[model samples]
Target: MKQLFISIFFLMNFVCCFAQEINDKEIDSLYKEDQFYAGVTYNLLGKMPKDVSQSGFSLGFHLGFIKDMPINKNRNIAIGLGLGYSANSFNQNLLINKDNTGSTIYSVLKDSNTFTKNKFSSHLIELPIEFRWRTSTATDYNFWRIYMGFKLGYVFAHTTKYRGDLGKLRFSNIEDFNNFQYGITLSAGYNTWNIFLYYALNPIFSGDASLDGNKIDMNAVKIGLMFYIL
Candidate 1:
């Protein structure tokens, strides 16, 4: 993690210097038209069950194209619509299982399991809409931006995997997993580096999904960096 932070810091500096080296004419041609959006985030599970805990790093990535429409004369403010594919993995200790009746259940694995890895992963096709504000001119390549948006996603796949004393096992197409998800997102920063956050408004699983007899109400929370390319 320390090395990751160091690399990011230097990368941002390099971008700043590179942007400065470019002339206004070139910068204008590059940034005047909004192009693609791509980003990665560190996932954090919020309001998780008391017995469940994260065991390692969780991460997510998105790739998409953005269509930006200027809402102001200066084009500094605009609204954007993006279509994207996103995937996420949550590395944790929770054991996802199915009872004899085939109901999905979430439980904690015993320490004796000596697990090497345990995780849940999902992929989605998503549409994101954003209201964007930026301190940018047609001739400027480096600028500050604030983007707030909401995203709707449909799950295409879901899986769980565990490698431990009992041996490696995987469960695909988990039952009762939510097929649709919606969330609010915010990204704010300067130049190529932006702070990104996402909060899911819906549970990860259907309301009827449970652990033992209790409802599973976990939602995903993600925070990290976002980078945009034009």
Candidate 2:
């Protein structure tokens, strides 16, 4: 599965690169004219996808506004700011942790028939700053752009629920899930309306590792649609 993700990253990059080569000059002219825009996007996040290969899918919606300032016109370097909301979760068997002191930690891992079915959901506020380049313009109103950016997110709301043979436990205020995830987002699509995909490089959990090595993988890939709302 990891290899599959790597392949996708490379493929998207290849397509973007080739397209840029063909229309780099044309795109450069228009990008300077459009420095700020606002849009709405609907995203589907697939979390712990390594485990939930068949049934793991989470949905998210984003209403964001971005402003761009040029650093270089030839390379298409710019700074951007954006805010969005996202939520995702999954269910599977796990082994929880319990401490002799302090609050007991639970590990609903990949193994253990103790059967730890859990759900993790979050409401996020994000600020992303990126550098983007554009290529391939069918016209001044429509073109393709490729951007690589970094996003920092704060968890405004987070919850983790566990259910096992022993019944149920809910941890709604703990900081088990890593509140910070830093990664590069590669986006490619048209200017009027585009399809954006993202991959997070960091794990979402920030505690001790359990038997399955905290098998609750935080790496996620999301697909979203972007368009002008204003």
Candidate 3:
């Protein structure tokens, strides 16, 4: 019994030591080459209707990978492709005051100012081709980059939730959401990683008489961590 106990203890200790050594070696050998990383982003759509105060901004979280090429000892560049999913929401509370026949009472909310919320969400596949300049080694990597790119996507899902004394109302457009959409991205960052800001000029919808301009714009600002895979 004593001999067995001693053997088991030695075996466990040996395994632990081996694992620790392997972990350190793995980290030391790792470099920013042909590696993949993912992160989150926030989108703020400005230039909204004057009467309507923007309540919801689009928020997105994504992951991507890059293939790097070394140009010289102090310079390198990389290209990457990634797929991500994102959701956007907008909410606002309005103060509606109406005077009917000398009697003045604030209604629930209506007309230009309404107590309601509109939300949009979609899943997207994005491809990013970025150029980077860096001074990093296998042990410690550091650099910065300027990336200009575009994303082409379609809305997979959409809905508008209107709640008031009327109870609840929901609208969904499976056809409209799939419409072709494109956006441009211009960003500057420090290190191989980048913080990007992007805007979409096209509107997802056309304004109709009933809804003025139900047009939805794809505008957002995103910040994420990036790595090079060569």
Candidate 4:
């Protein structure tokens, strides 16, 4: 009985040691690429109304984490899935206000002198999926990367503010603004600094808002620099 107990203890310890050795080997051999990223963008409105244009500075900020899954043996080619947050503000001449009956109104500002500031901002939660290709190695931290992907976002908070000669008008969570936004993204560069572009596939607003019976079809185009950390 004593001999059997000693044998069992020795076997358990050996098994544990083997398992630990395997774990260490797996970890040491594993190479993971860019799992975190942050970016800044200059926001622009595309396909604008006839007289609608941008003013001031339109900027966007984005940050996220991606799960890098290597598909090839070299690990340079991978697919990334991530969740991120984006805050974008578009400063433009489009004036959004409310009527006396509490209905929303949209119009273009012809005279810049009439208004102090008129702009709209939206904050969203975004999901990003990318096909990643890079010149990266296990020991090399500096490499060139070109990543293209699709991003789907949900606008959780939004606001439109107008401060002008007619006092200040501010609206929260405008119904006309589309809550669901999706776009295509591209990023390419070497090392940490990368050029990024996001072109929205859909309009930012619903078709209910119009100018002189013409549908106000507008989308967003953002181009900026992105930084990634492993």
Candidate 5:
């Protein structure tokens, strides 16, 4: 997945550069700022179910294109709408299995601690809308920027993988996982590198998933660095 993002990054970059060479000069009053981006994040599970604990590092990769429309005369303030892709993984102690009837079983992973891996992953198609502010000029190559946004994504693919004492087990397209997720995001910093944060507004799992007659509820939190390419 990481390799996929890297390929997208380079491909988008080449396209952008080629487009610029075809029309290298722009009217300062109508110029746009960075419009391509890629990021890496440390994924965290919030509001975890009782006894649930993360067992390994969780990571995420993202890449996208944004259409920047300046909102003010200075061309320093803008609104951006974008489409992006993200892949994320969360490693935890929550055990998921299926009964003979193919009904999913949920539990706090039990003894032997024999399991070597237990993780769930999601791949999303995302839409992001942002209000942006920056201290920049049409000719400037570096500047400070702040972007506040709302993002919504559709989980088109998902899976769980485990290996260890129980041998190998895998689950795909879990019906209990929420198909849509929404979040609030913030990204700010200097040229090239920026700090990015996202917090989900809804749980990742549906009520059909439970651990003690109560539903399992949890959301995602991500913190990372983002790189923008003009």
Candidate 6:
């Protein structure tokens, strides 16, 4: 995590320097614009135990509105503030259980009666902020862009599910899951298609949540495509 942050810091610096080298007059001629963004991503668990593994595809999707505010006289460089909603699911072998003491515990399910399908899902309201650069003109719709940002999310709903010969079981509004999440995001590409990456800065579960008496400090990583509309 420390190394990741260090790399991001240097990347941001490089982008800023590159932006400064562009022609000021040309940048000034571009118009500032607001946009709507929607995306679908594949989610992966990061920093998880080797014994705990994903069983199937983990998916996520989000939609949002962004208000762009230009920093320089040239509209090519701007800061964007957005409000969005996101939902994500992870299909894994870990089972979420409540112990006799009423504490949440994550355990690897492995037995004759072990679950055939297990998943954990979360829904969040998000606020995203980004520093953006684009090579665009008022008349041109196709452009290359690089956006680096962070998002703060509040989990409004969470669920855990299990299914097998023992029958299906589900628990909603799990109290042990972390209610707040934050992450760094990057998007870059040309025209209508963009590649997106997100790295969570916080764990998915609260510090008190444990797996085999060890804190389950797992973060989420997502990669996918994003589309923007003016």
Say which candidate scores most in lDDT.
5
Candidate 4 — worst ten consecutive residues by lDDT sum? Answer: 19-28
Per-model C-alpha RMSD: 3.5, 9.1, 13.2, 15.1, 3.5, 9.4
TM-score of structure candidate 3: 0.58
TM-score computed on alpha carbons, candidate 2:
0.60
Give stretches of model 5 more than 4 Å off. Answer: 1-27, 110-112
**Across residues 63-113, which tens digit of lDDT does each residue of candidate 5 receive?**
899999999998899999999999999989888889999999887786537
- Report how far off residue 125 is in candidate 3 (Å): 2.5
Per-residue accuracy of model 1 over 1-230 as CA lDDT, tens digit each: 66346545654564455454556344342244334666777888988877788877787877787788878788888999989999999988778776689766777785835898999999999999999999888776679999999999999999999888867878998867899989999989987878989999999989877776888888999888877766
lDDT for each of the candidates?
Answer: 0.80, 0.53, 0.46, 0.85, 0.86, 0.80
Relative to the true structure, candidate 1 has a C-alpha RMSD (angstroms) of 3.5
Best of the candidates, TM-score: 5
Off by over 4 Å in 4: 1-28
Clashing residue pairs found in predicted model 3: 33-229, 33-230, 34-229, 34-230, 35-229, 38-63, 43-220, 143-191, 144-191
Models 1 onward score TM values of 0.86, 0.60, 0.58, 0.87, 0.88, 0.83
Cα lDDT tens digits for candidate 4, 80-164: 9999999999999998888999888888889999998999999999999999999988767679999999999999999998989
User: How many Å off is the CA of 113 in candidate 1?
Assistant: 5.6
- Global local distance difference test of model 3: 0.46
Worst 10 residues of 2 by lDDT: 33-42
The residue-by-residue lDDT of candidate 3 on 79-179, one tens digit each, is 43444444444343322222355321222233533434544455555555544444455654334556566765656666655565555655555343435
**TM-score for predicted model 5 compared with the true structure:** 0.88
